[model samples]
Target: MISRHRKVLREARVVGSERRGTWVYYWVLPPALERLPALLQVPEPAASTSW
Candidate 1:
């Protein structure tokens, strides 16, 4: 018998920066966070509590 573990694969992201009057988000981060800063070069939506 063998036991296995299940891990969820969710690409969670938050707003970072904006440009060209556009709002972008890092919905899917790269292999690491460090890479995100250099990769993501845009702005995210404004934070809101109105779900």
Candidate 2:
């Protein structure tokens, strides 16, 4: 549940959701977002929205 922890990182904000399909978009806070790739190391869906 990285998405949940993403909140703890204080760097994630729910930007949008795709009701047509199962997907969510998040705005990863800059600095943290930068480090996220290395930290969580998970493949995320392509984000298509901004908070």
What lDDT tens digits, residue by residue, belong to model 1 across residues 1-51?
Answer: 111111122323322223345643223344557666776788788888875
In candidate 1, stretches whose alpha carbon ends up further than 4 angstroms from where it belongs are: 1-31, 42-51
Per residue, candidate 2 scores C-alpha lDDT tens digits across 21-43 of 57655554466556766987777
Which residue pairs show backbone clashes in model 2? Answer: none
What's each prediction's TM-score? Answer: 0.20, 0.25
